[model samples]
Target: MSDYQVFIGGSAGSIAPVITILSSLPADFNLTITIVIHSGTDSKVSISEILANHSALTVIEIIDKEQFNPNTVYVAPSGYHLYVENKHHFSLSVDRKEYYSRPAINVTFSSAAEAFGEYCIAILLSGANEDGAEGLLKVKRHGGITIAQSPKSSQVDIMPQSAIDNRAANKILSPKEIISLLLEYNDLA
Candidate 1:
C-alpha cells in the first residue's frame, strides 16, 4: 500500500473536531498526520498536550527540521510557518504571517501538496479567514484528495466555505464523516 499523509488546517473552533478525529484512530493506524492551526503567540495551554490526552497515538509539537513518522500526530508550533520538507521531514520558518496569523494553513498545505502530491489528503477545517483556500486548491491540482469541513459543521464557515467556493474541495463533510473517510483511507494505506 502507498504511504498516505494527512494534512489538516484550521483556526477558530477547530480543536474539538481535531481531537475527535485523532482520538478515533487506533494506535497502530498506518498513516501520518500533520496539522497547522492559526494561533496567537500567547496561547496558555499546549495544543499538543491537549491532543495527546485524547489520542492513543503519539502527539508532538514539531521542531525545526524534525523527521516525521507514521502513526503519529504532529502539531505545528506557534509563531512560525510549517513546511513539509519532504515525505520524511519537516522544516520550520519564522517568516511573516499570512492572513494575520503565524503558522498559516496555506504554508503547510501547499508544502504538503508539493512534497506528497497524490499521496496526500488535505482537509480544511473551521476558521475565520481564507488562508487555506489557495493551498487546498494546490493540493487538488496535485491530484491529492481534498476535503472541506461542511459549513453546517464548522463554527466559522469562512475557511471551509472559501475552499468550497474556490472549487478545491472534492468532499464537503461533517466531523463524523471526515473521521469515517480518514479511517477508510488508513485501511487503503
Candidate 2:
C-alpha cells in the first residue's frame, strides 16, 4: 500500500526547475511521479525525452490499458485526460475536456485523490492558466499532501498562484526547494 502520485503543472517555458528537481530524485524509490505538462497539440517537447536525458527512472507517456509500476514516471498524452483506477492501472478519457482544457490538470489530480487518497502528493508548478487549482484542492480534501511552486518565483506564476489563492496547496517553495521537500517526503513515504 506504499504508493505516491504527484501532479506537476507548468509550461515549457517554466518547467526546467521541475524537471531538474524530479530527475535528481532516486530512480529506485517507492514513489511514482506523474507529470501533467502543458503542450500545444503539435508541439514537440517529449516529456520522456526531457526526463530521459536526466532521470534514471523509467519514463513514458502512459498509454491506455497499461499496467502501472513504481519507480517509473507516467505522463498524460497531449490530447487525452489521464486518470487512475484503484491505483492498479491507468485510464484515458477523450470524450470532453475540463477546466476549458483537454488533458486537464484538475481531472488528473482529482482522480488520483480517489485512487490514492492520502498517499498522494500533488504539486503545482508554473503555468499560465488556472487549470490545476481546484484539482490540487481536491487532493488536499482527500488528505494528500499538496505542494505549490512559489508564485513569486515561478516563470509564469499564474498556475501556482491560482492554487495558493484557492487555498489548495499547503506548502509553497521554489523549484530547488521543492526538490528538497520531495526528498524529505520520500524519506517519510
Candidate 3:
C-alpha cells in the first residue's frame, strides 16, 4: 500500500463523530492517522485511551520527535502544538495558541501538508471556530486531499463550513460517508 497519512481536526461536539469514524475503520488499515482536538489542559480523561477504545488501531499520544508508524492513531497532546516534522516523524511546540487553541488544527494540517504533500489527506470535523479553514487551504494548495464534514451533519458547523466557504474541501461528507470513502481508498470495501 502507498504511504499516505491522514490528519483529522475537530473541536466542540466532534468526539462522537471521530469515534464513529475510527471504529468503522478495519484493523489492517495501513494509513497513519493523526488527530487534533480541542482539549482542556485539566481534563482528566486521556483522549488516546478514548480513541483506543473505539479503534482497532493502536492509539497513543504523540511524543516530540517520535517516528511515525502506519496503522497507528496519534493524538495531539494538550497544551502543545503538534506538527509533522517530516514524512517520518513528529515534533511538538510550546508556541502561543492560534485561534485560542494550543493543539490547533491549523498547525497540524499545515505542517502535514508540507511534509506529506500529495500523500496526505486532511479532514475538518465539527468545531465552534474557524481554526482548520486556512490549514485545509494549505493542504489543498500542496495537492493533498481535503475533506470537511458536511455542515448539515456536523454537531457544530462553523469549522467545516469555514473550509467549505474557503473552497478548500475536495469533499464534504458525514462521518459515516467519510468512513466509506476511507475504506474505499484503502480497498477494504
Candidate 4:
C-alpha cells in the first residue's frame, strides 16, 4: 500500500464538501486522512462527530502525539494548531492563531508537507480567507499533490481562488471531481 497521507483544509462553507468527500470513501480506504477546519474557539460542538455521521471510517478529534493510521479520519481540534510530526504521529499546539483562526490550514498543510514530502496530498476547499494558499504552495514545492476546489463550484470562492491565484494548486476541481480523484488513488493502492 502507498504511504500517502491526505491533508484537507477548509474554513467557511467547507462542512458540506468535507462531508461529501468523507462519505464517499469506503471504510477500507488506503490512506490516512487528516483535516483542519476553522471553527469558533469557544464552540463545544465536535466536528469529528459530524464527520462520523457521514463516514464509515473511524473519525476522531486529534490528540497530541497520536499515531496516524489508515482507514481513519482525524479532525483537528478547535483552538489548536495541528501538525504532522512524522508519518507515524501528530502533534497539537496552543500557539497564537494564524489568519485569526486556530487550527489554521497553513499550519497543518505546511507541517504535513514537511513530514510526508512527496507522499502528501493536500486539498484546499471552500473558505472566506487566504490562509491556505501559501501552505499549498509549500506542499507543491515539496513534490506533493495539491488540489483546490474550483472557484465556480465552491460555496464561497475566495479560499480556493487564492490558492489558484498563487499557483499553488496542481489541479482545480469541483468537490465531486475531487472525490473521483481520491477514489482513483484509493484504487491504485
Report lDDT per candidate. Answer: 0.92, 0.79, 0.92, 0.92
- Model 2 clash pairs are none
**Which ranges of candidate 2 are over 4 A from the true structure?**
none
For each candidate in turn, the TM-score is 0.97, 0.92, 0.97, 0.97
C-alpha lDDT of residue 101 in model 3: 97
Whichever of 2 and 3 has more TM-score, that candidate is 3
Score candidate 3 by lDDT: 0.92
Instruction: Tell me the tens digit of each residue's lDDT in model 2 across 146-165.
Output: 98888777878888888999
* Candidate 4: RMSD to truth: 0.9
lDDT of 2 at 60: 83
**Residue-level lDDT tens digits of model 1 in 59-85:** 999999989788788999888899999
TM-score of 4: 0.97
Can you list the residue pairs that collide in candidate 1?
A: none
Best of the two (2, 3) by lDDT: 3
